[model samples]
Target: MTGLIKKYIVYTAVLIGLLVFLHAIGALRPAEQYLSRGLNPLLATIYSWGTNINVAFDEQTGKADLWQQINDLQAETNQLISKNAELKAVEEENAILREYLNFFNDHSYEHILSRVISRGDITNVIGRTESILIDKGSTDGLRIGLAVVDEQGIVVGKVAAVKEASSLVRLVNNQQCKLAAGILGSEATNGITEGELGLTIKMNFIFQEVEIKKDDIVITSGLEETIPRGLVIGKVSDVNKENNELWQSAHLIPLMNTNNLLIVSIIKP
Candidate 1:
């Protein structure tokens, strides 16, 4: 097989050499030129097809690049939206802090600001938040029975338990919470306002002859240690006469909803 391949290669070389010799004498030169000229159009067509393939490849690459740019822009837009929401929340909280600072200034009270961290809910008693946790605690000069108020000087609760870094505030409507309160216009009819059913403030043991009316404002009487007077508690929502012939009671709606209290001030002793 090797000998046969070598013989064929020798024959091919001899044929090419004979052809070159004929062309040199001007015998096949004209025919060779004619053949080359005839192939020029086909060569040009092949070159054009290669150029089209290159253009198509470039166009595909450009489309891929364009899609990548669009995805990058979408991700940036989402980041900006999240950043804007955070800024708006910060602005609103700053406004709340400023209002509280000014209120304490005018009222001439020493106080510390605290942020509410969490809330307490009784699953058995739906829709009631009995207490909340604040960021400030015993380390921040917080202790039990210290009155806590919202930005507008509305009493919301008192510090019930304290830890090194946090404290629990029993809301004004918690049954365990009681305040020495006075009717806005009836100082002589001062009574203790106790939270009833984790829902409303019920001032009990009022004499039946006190002549109390609905919508009367109740406030702290300054009778308890560390609690200031004139802090708004709520308005009388309903009045009830006692079954025990000697006493009467009324329901008071809290001035602020505990569910919305995110910041508060602890009145210093």
Candidate 2:
């Protein structure tokens, strides 16, 4: 037991002596300072990396906000374009109404204004005449054989069949349509102006001795009861004369175009 005690004491004394020698040489202070300095540089580098990461995150957030604003502006631009198109359509319709007003004020005939609803022929006693349907009918005091004039007061057609709310008009360019017409030049030469091929007018049955020239204005000769006098029909394009035949002819182009019939006034009987 004594021997064991003596060895334990000897080991303890050596350990104490070694620790005292290390403390007395000033090595402990330098080592402590060295550890602190090395740790400081490592800590500072870690902090700098963390700061850069935070700054990059903030920049990414700002870009996301700016991108959203651009999308919102693009959506607003499309809505404005649709509104502009509707306004332009209204302006065009108003201009057409003004033209109708001017034509009504200048004429003296007992008339009723009507719009062309369709452009197709109806059943007629004179066979099929290329015709248009008007919106006015017997309820509006319209009847069969009423003369239809255009917005320029030029004869375009005559009402052929009348319904309660609509009427069919035989256009002047129809082959079945015949008007008592005359060439108003130095002296009036009256004849029947007939439609040819649904495209032209031909004033036939004129006397060969009559003096007719190109560009002469042809007007109604007032020979028909429903139609009146001085109503312009067409312009003379050329004269066809045959010495043997008693009848002379003149080719005329109608003053009114039936292809774009929009509005017309029926001359009431």
TM-score list, all predictions: 0.58, 0.55
lDDT of predicted model 2 = 0.68
So what's the TM-score on candidate 1?
0.58
CA displacement after TM-score superposition, residue 151 of candidate 1 (Å): 0.8
lDDT winner: 1
Report the lDDT of model 2 for residue 228: 61
Worst 10 residues of 2 by lDDT: 77-86
lDDT of 2 at 218: 76
- RMSD for each model, in Å, please? 34.5, 42.3
- Tens digits of per-residue lDDT, candidate 2, 124-149, equal 32333378777777768988877888
Native-referenced Cα lDDT, model 1? 0.73
In model 1, the Cα lDDT at residue 182 comes to 75
Segments in model 1 whose C-alpha atoms lie over 4 Å from true places: 1-106, 242-244
lDDT of 2 at 213: 78
